[model samples]
Target: MAHPISFLKGVCCGAGLMYFMDPERGRRRRSLLRDQCVHYCHKATRAAEVVRRDAQNRLQGTVAEFRHAFQHDEPADDVLTARVRAKIGRYVSHPSAIDVDASGGRITMFGSVLARELDGLLAAVRSVRGVGEVQSALRVHDDAGATPDLQGGVERRGERYDLMQEYWSPTSRSVLGAAGLGLMATCLGRRTPSSMLLGTLGLMLTSRAMTNLDTFKLLGLGGRRRGINVQTGLVINAPIEKVFELLSDPQNYSRLSDSIESVEDLGDGRYHKTVRLPGGAEAMLSERIVSVQPNELVRWRSEPDSFVPYAGAAWFNKLDDNRTEVQVCMSYNPPGGVFSHLAASAAHMNPKMLMDEVLMRTKQHLEGSQPSREEGGERTGAAASTGGHPAGSEPQGSPRVEGASSPAQAGEPVIHNL
Candidate 1:
């Protein structure tokens, strides 16, 4: 029952060290992380601006309402009539067909409205401020089939809520996320059964509000639609064939990535991996390579019952220079649902951070890693027989990947990142 919370914070400093202290690509990763932080800060600033504006407007509106409540003066006839029309517009199919006449403190409506909407329209018109009495001379219709006023008219949409909609605006999401966090913190601290239930509710609210994912995805219930996503691309200073060889073969992961303790190749493109968890613990995983193309692409998915189910793919494109661009995409089920996923992200144990480390190691291994044959003039007969070639030198007849037909571009969307 070791929870992700227990192992979370201890790994952040260590993860940062490995993430930024690597000999190769360390500077680049640090730069990218800094840019992300700056971008996020800008977004936060914009959101704060919007929130401030909204608060100011709400305050002004509240003040206006209070001031208007004290002094009662009937609006002009045209103004009151316009208000009545506005109030009842959404409840009926044809507001223009309704003629509103307002004089003194009384209002009258004369038009043909749908019979179903007549009651609502009268009610809405009656609710308008500065109106004393309503005089109805409206003709009602069951349908808009032959009525000239209701022809080709449709009812406007009524009041709808942001939370009730399929997609919420960014502002709504932020507000919900903030409220959910507060509720979770307040409820979970009581240490009671009821408090625990409330805390779980708060956690779901926070997760769904922030990620905008279905509950099923966050709970890791659906096939391939289970939550969490990691996607990024980088160019390594190695040829396409060399980079593909290192990435496509699972055996090299242990040496190339700090997160991997070992990868035991089971032949036939299957492997079992021992992964180092946050607090120095380990988790076992079994994955079978689902597809592969020689020096071009590699795709794999975790076997059922694996510690954390995941699927990933990597694409290789040979640049004009000797470098290769590697675009990787991965989705994985969180070990303990979305709560644990968020915890791991806070602890730098998320897939994005791990992939950054792994790709950095790959860059280091492929770039200038081979030993020189003329080091201190200590050359063996085997080195001479190999024509002074480096140990990691290219093999014969490796195709030069120079077109866009094989791999997607860096900015192109790969798999569904959600």
Candidate 2:
């Protein structure tokens, strides 16, 4: 097979040589090919030059525009200060709380401001005409009694009043109870197995209505009354003290968790956190450190007026000289009642998965390794049943908590004591 194939290749090569080496036509054909190559090469070079020139022109235009927008000739200190103040007044809320000082075209802003508002305020002041530089000495809300107006106007107040009234009204509860009784009556008339089940459900609904509980809350089908719990644990190859230091600082949360966009220190153990939601939306939450037990435990609770009320605790247990086990527990009430509960369940937005991801990232960051997927099944099995076991005896598994983002493996830890 090899010999025949080689002979065929040699014959083909000879035939091509005979055709191309035709004395008169071969030379002209070769010359035409060379000329065409040279022509295309020159054309390509000219095209390249044109593209280069166009790119240079575009870069110059961009630089000029940037300079025109950002760079300005210095003006008198008083004039620059006035310009900056005007800018701030136009953009920032509670302008009266801010004090402006100017020296050699540099503007300094001092006062109490909301953490979310500070970045935009500073950027606006710096962009003002005639201002050379801007500095902020702004204290946050907790430091200076500058809490933002989370509640709005008279109409909003009225709506809140109405909602509270509805929640507490005996008449509303009576109506729900009547409907449940009617259903029970229908079930009694039918007297079948399905009818009996329906009657039982109706009786339960009636009991809930009598007790002033919502249907979803009574049935435990949604997180309307009770908050969802999530718990996760991980072992990090870092000292407990070092891990605690990083976890204690609110500012470090944004770096540790992908869901947290930013953490603003509001002073006095309080922080304002901006979190990114599943669908590119964002939410602002206020949290305060409620307890700190050095390298052992840190606990935080959401502010009273937050959109979603939540509490979280991180427990640090030293495993060895350079290894530590971190256990996190979070309980939260999803906003918007049953609808929000359904949404959260559908989106798989549970705290357990979020905490697991956070721990994984923290471990990678401390150990100087690239982040990888969460490994192993949750370790909550025997440890959760032990009822607050010693730190050293806590199992290295995740807890089987309600509202888990993912299905748990068999023997998953269940935490009813969070």
Candidate 3:
């Protein structure tokens, strides 16, 4: 999250670098400007202010002239760049990437920077007046040095999905409760005797547990949808390890996440992640690594009864040209019997949108990572290497993934028990 202001300041610094690096040009330019400033300064104590105002006023006209030249599509001047640079340099604290040349306006920046901040940059430039339109064919690089990580504030998108899910839980619970009451009444009406009632109660308990398990399975599936699950994906232009490094680091919560507070790796790829909710609520999720095949996939599951009933899994796949696709799936059973149902329902409604946020952020993180090709393309699973297969890899287990599937396919179907 590079601040537009900071970038503009950097642009000014870059100008200064160019100035000092070529002192002859700087000195010559300063000598000409110095004479004008001195003559104006002699008139009053506010001479510098007057001179600055005059320079700015003149620059405005020059900028307007450039705009006209562009509108008419006429040949522009090359000296305009130096002239405008010198003029604006005297008034503003720093110069932005809005440098001009005799031909047109030339801006030097990173592609990511342009992608992230071009709108703001353009807005600032437009305010300068005189500038008709920007003629930019600037080539931006993917520089590790220029990638600035902004502080993670509240994740409105994630929180919105979470809140919607939370609200849905109540509605779901009401439906289930009504369904349960109807079931119980029907059983009582049949009156198969006292023994039958006991059996019915036992069946209900088993059924409830199974239902909870079934919910978990849905959350663990890649891009799987349930009543309210929102699924989304993003592409990363870096290695999986690098993406994982940022995702695995709790400190990066401040850098990459909007609302995650902390994530403590609980050994064996299990983790305790605490995320902030909208309206100041906090959710503590206990997640276990249901499956982990480095550079390919990482899946986690957590039951509502254990530390946290909410479960989530992330999968990473490498694509061509150093790009990677990451997907996240999460499901949660709300807390408290009735409230839990509402929450669960809410989780179902927009699982795709929430998951989309995870993927997009992951993409941004990976694309912004240090550029260096890893030694290997993908990591082979230990289970596959050994005489073992993922939990659901066998035909007798869950269905096989079509092709180039990660080990996560095994953990998906089992997410929902009942």
lDDT of candidate 3 over 1-418, digit per residue (tens): 6599999999999987787557567776576558657854774345334446655776797798877666743224545444444443333222343345444444222222233334444444443323445544433323324433322222221113311342223223334445656666666667677646755664453334324333333233322222222234567787766765544333343233234455665566555655544345555655555666677765656633343344456667778657777776554433332233334334321223334333455554454532232454432211100001012112232212111111111111111211
CA deviation > 4 Å runs, candidate 3: 1-228, 248-251, 303-307, 336-354, 368-418
- Candidate lDDT scores, in order, read 0.64, 0.59, 0.42
Using lDDT as the measure, the top candidate is: 1
TM-score of each: 0.50, 0.39, 0.31
Error of 3 at 295 (Å): 1.0
Residue range with the least summed lDDT across 10 consecutive positions in model 3: 383-392
Better of 2 and 3 by lDDT: 2
Query: Cα-based RMSD of the predictions, in order?
Result: 13.6, 33.6, 30.1
Backbone clash pairs for candidate 1 read none
Q: Write the per-residue lDDT of candidate 1 for residues 95-195, one digit (tens) a residue.
A: 88988888897998888888888888777777788999999999988888888899887766544475765455555666777888887897867878887
Location of the lowest summed lDDT over 10 successive residues in candidate 2: 381-390
Among the numbered candidates, top TM-score falls to 1
Give candidate 2 misplaced runs (Cα > 4 Å): 1-226, 336-342, 371-418
